[model samples]
Target: MKIVNKLKYIGLAMLTLFVSACEEGFDDINTDPNSPVEVPASTLLTNGIFNVGYTYWDRDLNFEFGELMVQHMAQNEYTEEQRYSFATSDFNFRWGNLYSGQNVAAPTGGLYDLSVARALVEENENLSDAQRANQLAVIDIYMSFGFQTITDLWGDVPYSQAFQPGEYPFPAYDAQADIYTGMISTVTNAVNSIDTSVDGFTSGDILFSGDMAAWEAFGNALLIRMGMRVGNSAAVAAGFGGTLPTSDIMLTFDANQDVANPFYQDKVISSRDDFRISAELVAAMNAQSDPRLAMYAMPAPGSTEIVGMPYGLGDGAAFTLKNSTSDIHTNIEDDPTAPAYLFSMAELEFFRAEAIVSGYITGNDATAFAAAIDHSVAQWGASSPGYGASIAYGSSNAEKLNAIALQKWIALYTNGVEAFAEWRRLDHPALTPSANMAPGVTGIPVRMLYPNTEDGTNGDNLAAVGTVDLGTPVGWDN
Candidate 1:
């Protein structure tokens, strides 16, 4: 899965010289081929941040796998994902575009570029201790978030020796248990490392232009998220209470399609209208009279009704049903700049409700549940009749827990990966497995398959590693 293309090794000077050799002002004698040019930390930071959730992540994680399995949407073409039969090659883009990367490479991963940015900050002679701390902390949070998410999705992965190509060309896959433990430490360090005294100077801080409060909250939000992922006994109490209010960390898009939300950019602006709303999601929303349904999807063409496509239909079958199924709404579609909620106050409220459900904290279940619903509505910026009156908070804590999980799933429409992770851990809404699954694919997949690159480049390491099936849960799922 380590496919960097070695393109980053090709320096800009070499390309320029090769192209301009016939130019009159070309001076091969004065140019030093050995001189190394480093890209600025600021540029790398923005690029890394954008790469994390945009392009590949949106397609592979959000649409291809997460949304399909979660029943948010079904693929209209190929439809292999809807059938729950995916190939190893289907996941190769994750490694090449997100998990594995090299310096200056096209499609550089979030952690790879961010870690490179961190290195630059650490090595800069002019930076003060506080300045370095401020910059490094941001990278640390992103690195930890990327590692945590990758491991959550794929189980055991190359973590400790992943970025260090010189030391371990074919890094051994780390165990999910060990990876989770390490991520807790890494995220904890990042959350505590923010130094507000020094300015986070930059020209390329796209997510949050040097806002220390936002950055620190982002780190804490990540910390709480990771802490909960592994079911830490003390995490609920320590990570919640008042902390939930201010710990939202997210990527906001402008109202312009020029730089709108990544998914918005791909589907609406790019005109890749390949996905339609899933019947499961639409039916559930309609049953509860959820007001967000209108904001989430549009009516079918030439029809005033809003319906979703049946889950896991073949391409031909879906084509026939296309007239009935709804597409994404203009609220999200026309407004290309709609914010892609990575982490938000609404999610924090759900965590609070979950903590109470797990007995990790003491709070009124109904109160917390209501708060979560309100937060979710506010997060969408859509007016609603509200969930309190219709969607009842059940009497028992067990029933409440199911409600909380299912409600969270509904609220997490755009954040498909996180929704999948929560489904694996919480097991609510009871998603049904697709009929007539593909060979080797079991019920709805709990984990992603390793890429085909491992079979060739690291066959020995791949062999030594344990088996990975879609049905098998990761280390933290229990």
Candidate 2:
């Protein structure tokens, strides 16, 4: 009876082994097709491009900080920033957006995505010579733009060893000057890498849709802008160590739901009453009889005057607006489908004018200035009856500079961050400091404080940069 029981157990064990072997085959047959092993380069590019301009610049820098610092707009209720009271910061998020910040589902990571996108094309064994060159060139442009935005805002940031995930858990900060120099080289290589004979990343591209000409123009324009930013127009004149762009770099949006103007989305469609034009902006525009005024603000209550609210005036402050203070105009407030209006022919012309003034280029300042005014004025789709007569460029160096700066200020309405940077660079329009300054704060901030993320993880590295305060200028603020 014992021998019979042992034989029966052995037979059962053999049947169990057969079932386990068959289950291994079932896994291979049932592998999920819907799951993706790797993201495509095109999707990465789309996310990176939109997030940089729309997510980081348009929202965080422009909406939260830029508008007030430049004295363009202010808030009534949540006016802590306007009052010069900065808390920790959006810098970590800024870094993430550009390098590895968590973006919305599907499309995310700024420079990180671009870097991976470039690698994707470079590593692909099937792509032809032209395909590789064009794709890499576009990626280079994206990288340069991302880098400039970083150095310009933060002064010193992780770059040399950044973005190397496990390798650089705590990347060292590179000086802004060094970062700018490297960016010049990167942009140059990008321009050279573009193979006009081959196709580009057309389907994946949102800005210009793979047009190499637009890409080239964008890269070169960025180079010029960065060069000028460092007060080195001569370097920009020679193309930041290479060739300058002759063509224009411009970005205009239509009524596309996916890629509409952020301002329209926030203020008009959502109907949020968080922000309004600042007093300084209204006074300055009205002083110049600027044609772009009406397009920016509505007339004050019971008066034709388009007055704006004072900066730093928080809740219960001496102000008069019935829940709304000079809301943005119909063109912007009404059209959720409005444009981001990235750059203008006027802006390029202004750069040229400033380059000449700084002795970087040999063009006539007056001519360049006049041309800049014409382009900028026309960009607003407004008419000034006596532009050449009343608002013409001045004669003296200081006067002409002020004129250039003032006009540039007017031209840079929605583009608040760039406007703020220029204000620090040139001191144009000479904005009056708000009386509602935060306690212990001296004046309006020239550069935002370093993000607190560095304080916890990169504490030692952050210390090397020195103490961050409101009055301390950024590295390039020289």
Local accuracy of candidate 2 as per-residue lDDT tens digits, 130-239: 88878877877776776666666778776665544344555567777777776776676777777766788857787778888777777777767877888766447755
Provide TM-scores for the models: 0.87, 0.85
- Please report the candidate that would top TM-score against the real structure: 1
Q: Lowest summed-lDDT stretch of 10 residues in model 2?
A: 16-25
* Per-residue lDDT of model 1, residues 1-478, tens digit only: 1122234423321221001000111111122235433777777677667656553336677777787878888666677788887778877666555554322323343555665566677779998888777787777666666666687888877766555444455767778777767766665565466776567756667777887656777766765677677877454455563233353456656545544665666677677766788889989888888878877888888888788888877778877777667887767656655656678777887887777777777887677788778777766767765554467778887888898888988888867788888888888989888775787776888888777866677767777777777787888875
TM-score, cand. 2: 0.85
Candidate topping lDDT: 1
User: What would you estimate as the lDDT of candidate 2?
Assistant: 0.65
Per-model C-alpha RMSD: 8.1, 13.4
